[model samples]
Target: MSDPTATGPAVPPLDADVIVVGGGPVGATTALKLARGGMRVIVLEQREATGLEERATTFHPPTLEMLDDLGLAEPLIERGVRADSYQFRDAKLGKIVDLRFDILSGDTRFPFRLQCEQSVMTRMAIAALDEEPLAEYHPNSRVGTIRRIDGHVEVDVQSGPRRGTIRAAHLVGADGMRSTVREQLGIGFHGHTYPERFLVISTQVPLQEELPDIAYVNYIADPVDWHVLMRNPSGWRILFPAPPSWGSDEDVLAPDNVLRQFRRVLPDRDADAIDWVTLYEVHRKVADRLRDGSTYLVGDAAHVNNPMGGMGMNSGVHDGYLLAEILLRGHAGEEVDADLDRWAERRRAVALDFVGKETEGNWSALRDDDEQRRAAQRAAWEALGADDEARHEFLLTSSMLSSLRG
Candidate 1:
């Protein structure tokens, strides 16, 4: 909905304390936080609404703590399921290593992982923003151009029948992987795509009767068709790493193809219950810089990691939180240039050192057919299984609690 006052001729062509160029979770949360802090915020989304197609269903403990700070923990708990542990299986050894979330019990309020669709979180954030007077949501509004003049940032926007300019003290590009704002600012996103593609299928059948009470991330480390299966409220989400020679643009979501892959990876599941399937090419990329003057990039606009560890969405939300804090500090007459720099540096370190490495390693372990690679994986798991300290360290890393530290 357009703001009436903002549409009047008496009003300035563009006016806002901050302009967020993306209505995804990151941008929406940043705008909502700013509005809550009494700053006038405007968010522009190219999409008709904030309903995203891809699903990032796992929220780690640290991310849950950040959501709690935003007063969203209760609502999220109501709408999502909790995951207590992750099970890493080495089929060659017939050994399963259980990494529990209890290690973070003393460090954060949310010691367990939460499984909720990205769409659900977006809808919640949108509703929260709607109740804030200082926040205005502009869906179907695409940002065409951006310019930084003097001390203010200007943006050319097109929404339905209207085309206009928006000006703000600060601008944020939380758009996505192919961010228009990032392009406009000449920030380079550097990384390469994995040769292998990933196919994700969602099914309604109950695949956890053996461990019904515990929600664990299952990593099947088979060289032929390594996969991950996660439990959701409605169904189980299955992820398969396809061979490098798989089809590129063709529809891989067909039931036959999905069933074939499912049978190949997880032979135990019932194929008749498959509901939805999607195939995506995985890319590991990060922006060269997070900020340029009054404009900053957050979420996928800044970095995109493989979804193996479910860190992509979690890291994006964390970016929003960090940016919101810095912006609020700046608004309160604090010299936050150093704070902003630290935010970017620390985030990039975590993304590169933890998320990037873990996801890439998971991909390699899944795809490697060499006997040496299999033996190494077996040895690593054996060591991890024998030592509780090692198991906890692995859990902390997978749960993203380890990366929460500065």
Candidate 2:
């Protein structure tokens, strides 16, 4: 283990109060929060440029509330679609339950899912960071080694031909799942990968015109073919499970195969309507710990669940927000050891217990082949939807308000 307790030379001049090792949504959130809190912050990102890919399109209600607090929600909502309700559907029988976010009106201010690409949030955050004098945003900067010295953290960064060292009071690892900080710190990420890869097809097709009575988001369950369909500002996105039997990547991404999946939703679906396709593996992994000495992990570096309930990115944003709050309190000399401990414990617990199980349950419920279980699942959704109180409670949990509250 890289021990922060190891005796070292005196602390050197600090580059910033906190050094954030990624410039994505989570790192931007952490850096912006700290900079706004009157701490000098630096964000290092290795990407040369941002892509137009539609990654992580669903933002739950509580996540928007948190972003609103950071002054980032409104612009994103303006550029995105608002989904007031989502449906649990059966391929053969049709919609089983239409769960509306309006049921969470009393529980949260933003009682709807914001269907915006994550790039929008990151761009807005980076723009905000650029305006803040206390924050420095560095792109094309890759972080290497991490070392602890005299109660501070030091990191090696490589940007182009320049090699530099930055020392900070603390370091936050929000760099995606393949995080350099986590690897350098020797932290273990424990979990399993799903056998079937997930395939996402982005299309400009107005699916609402073709499908009857479809909401902005729909989870369609079928014994033979389970999939998720959602609408973004661009148009629509469909997710399908790609078993190994699907053949090679080129074969699965073939135009004919893409259209086959679309035709499963609607037989007359046009092949030319599809814009692009992506195939990637999914995993349910959580880091062994959120904090190791003065360095902390947030976002994908800390935990990653399947994007079933759209909880992966939302929960990661929550991590950055909560960690920043705790760190700010500690900086104020408020004796925040307990606060830090509580934050770490609670965040990890949420990842493993709440998000892990919720997403796994979603995937399982959608793909279960047994007729009895399908009937029971449908009845459960009906019972939950029929009762106002029960529906409200269910919406609270699904919208992530209950998770944040607890």
TM-score: which candidate is best? 2
- Quote the positional error of residue 362 for candidate 2 in Å: 0.8
> Per-residue lDDT of 1-406 in model 2, one digit per residue for the tens?
5558879774468989999999888899889999998889989998875556767999998889888988999999999999999999998888899888887787788989999899889999999999999999988999988899888999888774335898999999999999998998898999999888899998887889888699999999987788999999988999999998999888889889989987876677687878888998899899999888888999999999999999988999999999898889888888887788888999999999889998999889999999999999999988977899999988887788888875
Q: Rate the local accuracy (lDDT) of all candidates.
A: 0.81, 0.89
Q: Per-residue lDDT for 1-406 in model 1, tens only?
A: 5566675355344489999999898888888888888789989999987665657888888888877777777798888888877767764544366667777687678888888887887888888888999998888899999988768899999774335887999998989999999999998999998777788888776667744533457777877757788887667888887655666446466566678877764577666667777788889999998988888998999998888778898898888788888889899999999889888888878778888998888767755789897878777876876787887777778788778765
- Work out candidate 2's RMSD over C-alphas: 3.8
Task: State the local distance difference test value for candidate 2.
Answer: 0.89
Pairing residues by index, what is the TM-score of model 1?
0.91
* All candidates: TM-score: 0.91, 0.96
The lDDT leader among the candidates is: 2
| Candidate 2 accuracy as TM-score | 0.96
